[model samples]
Target: MSEYIKVAVDAMGGDYAPQEPVKGVVEALREKPELYVYLVGQEDVLKKELDKYTYPEERLEVVHASEIIETGEPPVHAIQKKKDSSLVKALRMVRSKEASAFVSCGSTGAVLVGGQVLVGKSKGVERAPLAPLIPTATGVSLLIDCGANVDARSSHLVQFARMGSIYMEYVMGVKNPKVGLVNIGAEEEKGNALVKETYPLLKECKDINFIGNVEARDIPKGVCDVVVCEAFVGNVILKLYEGVGATLISKVKAGMMSTLRSKIGALLVKPALKETLKSFDASEYGGAPLLGLKGLVVKAHGSSKANEIKNSLIQCITFSKEDICGKIQENMKQDNKGDN
Candidate 1:
């Protein structure tokens, strides 16, 4: 293990790439003294962006890559053909143990593909789930399989629940985290074949604290710590969560400014409102981790800014320090042994 938690960041991946990604790296390096970063992108463009900030030069290195993978390109083909692309290069760094983790605001499809193909999965990990922490009324909950494994089986969902439990307990500091199967009702038999099949398996699973069903509407109220589902439903929940949160914030701002009286009230509540809104911002929680991978791979929003990038990088530190991959591997080993 290196003294620093080294991360290979895709500097040219996001919409604000080179600029936001570079700025975010600088911010993370400054904030985390024990962080080392390799910014992978076109050398000249990354250098130009780096010139704008004064960061710890010793901790930051620029690794040049020649190709760029556009969002429209097919993910598997892009990763296969664009050998020198920033995203692929960073993933290879993680595969080679040159970095402890890989962080990118790049194409999600490309990241997901490169992660499984390059970094690979831990032993006994059926599938890697994209788990992101989402804000709830009480605090935050982990949504597993948010964008990976859409046609996942019941067994895949069971693994997602277990992996999500480990993440929330170790990374998020939630003890004995409650696991909930995402469903349409609280009844055990009230879901599609997948949910119904997985529920019994989770309930019988002794390692995690399975808490039964978690309705979509009940998710925001923090009904469970780990919300488990296949990618399709989980993705819909995530997208709707973001959309509703943003719309509510916008509506509040508009209403506040609509009348002179409301404007005066808004002035008095702006500070509190701002803090409340910030807590609910998805970016504030960092990028989603593709859990169950041999090495860590975090995917930030495509339109992520410097702040989101910074938070994502910081999260990698905790993830590496906790040896999340090792822990997940050990858990899977235990599960396999139990079956035999």
Candidate 2:
């Protein structure tokens, strides 16, 4: 709402924090002079890092704190006891209208729990999802309820579909994106009670382009623009997607190195292979955004480096500039009216 976009970076949240993420923030500012940021973490440590670079005095701030929350700490306990910790202090700024967005690489569980409790939720929303994206052949796809609500319901899937569709269209520039419910089979009647109930609702929905079921195999095939599933299933799929991509790529390289003839061919084809495989590299796409929160919240990968952190910061820049939260609120209001 203010003239300048503001973001709170969790300087100590990720696996390589106060250094790697901090470095990323500095790089992001270099590219976008319009954006402002508040680096939240231990006073002495944060300042020491900031001293390594020179940024605009008014455009950046360092919010000093004394405590650091480990990703392993339980969310409820960490948030309560470590009130002065970087994560809590950062979220409080958003709650108090001091910052427009919050970014953390700390704990996924802590963000989901603390975001809902402190940042609050949009009206009429029952649950919020950690919505990250996966690169598809067409471009990218938004996968909702990724790890937030693993045990979701029929109605919850409906909301995920609705939200995912809106996100792809508004943020990712996909028009009339198709929504698919993850299932074991394409048959209308082939699913658990919740999936069975959700199928009909998606089929009847007029607000989105509701395609039918998408098996896990069809995901990388780019079958749908948006893949919808409960968090448990979605989380498993995400982990496997990353793991398999890494393993397969590693195997291909190892195979090429086994013989001299193959090594020559690998050199001949190395450039094309790298370009082709770049799409599957997760860091290129940046961190996942936790949707349905009142403010923008992004979860950079736990081991994010400077580039990843910078990309995540750039994501927040575009998100606020596009008014993603407001657009989502508008779309949800329309969905609610139709339900009524």
Best by TM-score: 1
Judge candidate 2 at residue 228 and give its lDDT.
Answer: 91
lDDT of 2 by residue, 182-271 (tens): 999989889888889899888877887988999988888888888999898889988898899989989999999999999999999999
Model 1 C-alpha RMSD vs. true structure (Å) is 1.5
Going through the candidates in the order shown, the clash numbers are 0, 1
lDDT of 2: 0.83
lDDT of 1 at 42: 98
What TM-score, to 2 decimals, does candidate 1 have? 0.96
